[model samples]
Target: MHKFGVWAPKAQKMSLCWREQVLAMNGPNHRGWWTLEVQEATCGDRYAFLLDDDSTPYPDPRSLRQPEGVHGLSEIYSHGGFEWHDQLWRGSPKTGAIIYELHIGTFSTEGTFDGAIPHLKYLADLGITHVEVMPVAAWAGKQGWGYDSVSLFATHEHYGGPDGFKRFVDACHATGLSVILDVVYNHFGPVGNYTGKFGPYLNENRKTPWGDAVNLDQEGSDEVRRFFVDNAIMWLKDYHCDGLRFDAVHAFLDLSAVHFMEQLSTEVERLGATVGKEFYLIAESDLNDPRVVRPREANGYGMDAQWSDDFHHALIAVLYSPKEGESGYYSDFGTIADLHKSLKHAYVYDGQYSGHRKRRHGRPTDGLSAHHFIHFDQNHDQVGNRGWGERFEHLVGTDAAKLSIGIVLLAPYTPMLFMGEEWASSTPFLYFADHEDEEMRRLVAEGRKNEFAAFGFGGDVPNPEHEKTFLDSKLKWDEQEEGNHGDFLAWTKALIKLRRSHVCFNDGDTHHLHVFSDERARTLVMEREEARVVVNFGDQPFAFALLEGEQLELASRAEVSVREGYLDVPPMTLAVLLSTSEQFENRQVEARARA
Candidate 1:
């Protein structure tokens, strides 16, 4: 016999309908929890619960796996059935990790978890240690970015559902790669959400961009908080994921003492201890608060890391300068000083005035490791939300594009690469959704075009609701084998190799960053620690003054130099230099360690 239980506090009565049998249930303590025993209901049995006076049955809110999609019946799944081979996998920590973020639907033509497996070897070859997939929870449509997730516990059916996810993760572990899943807990998708109809899952007392916020701190919220917290633990325990990237945490407008994030973190850590595995949580917050990543011992939320938008904005703004058109958030950060502070310190507006927010924002992250921040030049949000969904190469030239990639991989922080960014793919990552409602489709299309107009890119805004727009966003994998795309792939591969081979580029070090710009000389020099990166960001050849004892470790093969103390950096090229003494000493240390 199988025992089933569900929490439906508001319902007067509940019944479990299992394979042509209706089992009546009642709670002993008025908690509204109903339980039933079934002889034939083992794993893979279809089931649903009927509330008092409701004709339509509802899927279990805590369903383990929904192979039939969210709108269909829930399935009884045995989490222990799958064989795991990662017994010795201790997991890689956030420190010194290179994260590559991807969306399953558009990442490959198959648009399923199984389709993503073949690309794992490619990511591993690029020296990526972790793969951060965007939210895969079952949403309203057949195609989406996964942010519009309605079912927190179920994987999207179109992406081959739960079993397919298991295969994908298994492949990742086999290749020694950690998986980080992006999760959205602040709000539900706008469609196919039936939680509010059953109980008070939403709080009208607070509001967010997606309408009412989750009922985290409001009345009848005990079970509600448990509902979300249990979902978080499910991903870590049942799925064996290494970490979670919480999306838009600022939307969680909770005034409670404990806060939802702290409660979730505590539960995740407890689950990690039980399984003898390491689990982490990373937050995406626009508030720029240090408290987000601060440890619980210091009276902070204790999240592992966070996406640093300040670093991205500073880097992109400086690289794609003439930011008058369509740069949006990149417009306010077009300066060498912005890039300097972001590199040395994590935040650019630490207690300083932010022109974007028009207020004093952020706090100093003193004594914090660079591992606490994840840096990137391009991400899903940066490209998709734009008018044309252009990638970095679309905005900047080849040399500058390569320069941005070099800086991100070499910077002293956890780095992230968006899908298709490695080869400078031409496909735009646009905001597309398969909303069946015509009214919603029109609203999304018009809203997107109007939003871009405010940023001065209105004339050529593509209609987001068009089928062609969505089709245009899918990557053409054939491009990876030919022309500039092939060259970019080779360049990125070399950079990743250099990063993995050098300890100086690893996380957790603060070196003074100095950027020397000479407009007439057409050269820029960036010095960090014992190494210096010289770039010719102009049209003419420029000579760099190497320190007396400096030795050229690596330079763009296009560069030419006659002497040790002097080198000519060709226009639009990059070079790396190091002291001969330091290089030889580190080489010997590496050799001894290997021996």
Candidate 2:
């Protein structure tokens, strides 16, 4: 026996379409919910809902499994079907974690959950504590970034559905990797979005970049808010995910007293307590507001952390200058000073005038832990949104890319790496989507070209509608062991190994963090206790003064050499130096005891 329920307040008559039968449902019963039961219905049974004498059926607004497609019937799914092998997995905390973000559709050649499972051990071996999977929610079409999702409750069928997703998560846990799923609660896809036909899920008065904003605080929006909140819980609970990374949270315009984020966070905490597992909520925000990660008791959103774009922007701008009139948000960050500020303070625009937005932006993160900021040199947005979808190494040389990465990994914050970034894969992560609508495809391709042209990016923009675009974005796993790619991979592994083995690299004490930069020489030095990172961004070699007993731990390039009182760093190189004093070693023991 199975019970079916849906929130369709305006329906004059609601009916359940289970298998070949059409059965009338119960009433809207006060809270706009209609319920029905079928004794013969069981797991795997396909179902849809009918409203007001219409013969046409619509997929469940909270569909768990869209086996056929987003436009097809919903299938009943039970979470107990899959056997999980993570009973002993206590889950790793996001603090001091090395997160690896990958799009499931592009991370593997098969583009499915099962296909991605094979690489979990590789990531775990690479010292990744969390595997941040890009959106896997059911979206329209087979190939997409999963941002334009049509069904929030269902896993993408192309990625092997809900069962496949569970297996992947279980495999990740078995391989000692926690999973962080990227979820989009800001907007729905432009196509195959039927939530409006059932209830007020979107605010018509407000508009976002995609379409109408989600009805977070409008009339008849309590249930709408519950819908998204429940969706988040479903992922953490039934899917057994360790964390969720909210996508484009800055676009969510909620004016409620207890903001949607607060409500969601509060409920998630309760759920975590009930499940007896720690679950983190990460937000991808461009606002640079520290309140996003502050505690709820402090009148904040209570998010675990947020993506700090200023760090990436400052580092990238200093390493490789963008074309004139093409800076966008990078306009305010093209100097060693900006990088220096980012190292000391997480945000360069913390309550400062910005030439990018032409206004003062960002509040200071004065009393916050640096772990609340997740820094990354490249991500899906930074790479895929490019005119040609060039990776960081493609824009700059390998040495410069390595230099930027060394700073990010050694910074006093949680660091994330985009898929294939460890090996510096040559494949481009293009912005590709497959829309069934021909006109929508054409418009997407055209809009992509115009968006880049406006940013002063020249050359041909890849047609996002082309199948080749999606295929080209898939990571070539074979290249990981080829030529310089193999060397870079080894270098990255050594960096992460050094990060884990050293006590200073794991500390998030930004107050004690000291950074010095010379704009004329294009050199920077970051000192975290006994560890020092020396970077040379200039075309010419730079000599950096070293402390007594400071030994060279690692170098991005092979041209690093030690003099009597200084270390020589070749252009576009970064070198790590460690002071192996007895006092620092004693502190390491104390730190471990406190932990």
- Top-lDDT candidate index: 2
TM-score of 1: 0.92
Tell me, by TM-score, which candidate is best. Answer: 2
Tens-digit per-residue lDDT, 242-264, candidate 1:
89999999998788899888888
Q: Which ten residues in a row have the lowest lDDT in candidate 2?
A: 580-589
**Model 2: lDDT to the true structure:** 0.90
The sequence of per-residue lDDT tens digits that candidate 2 reaches over residues 1-595 is: 9999999888899999987989999998998999998888999999999988778899998999999999999999888888888888878976669999999999999999999988989999999999899999999999999999989999999999999999999999999899999999999999888998889999999998899999998887999999999999999999999999999899889998998888989999999899898898999999988888899999899999999999999998887778876888888888889989888888999998998899999998988888888999999999998998999999998998888788878988889999999999999999999998899999998999988987788778899999999999999999899998999999899989998988677778898888989999988888888888888889999888776667898999888999889899899999999886675677667889999
lDDT of each: 0.81, 0.90
**TM-scores for all predictions:** 0.92, 0.97
What's the lDDT for candidate 1? 0.81
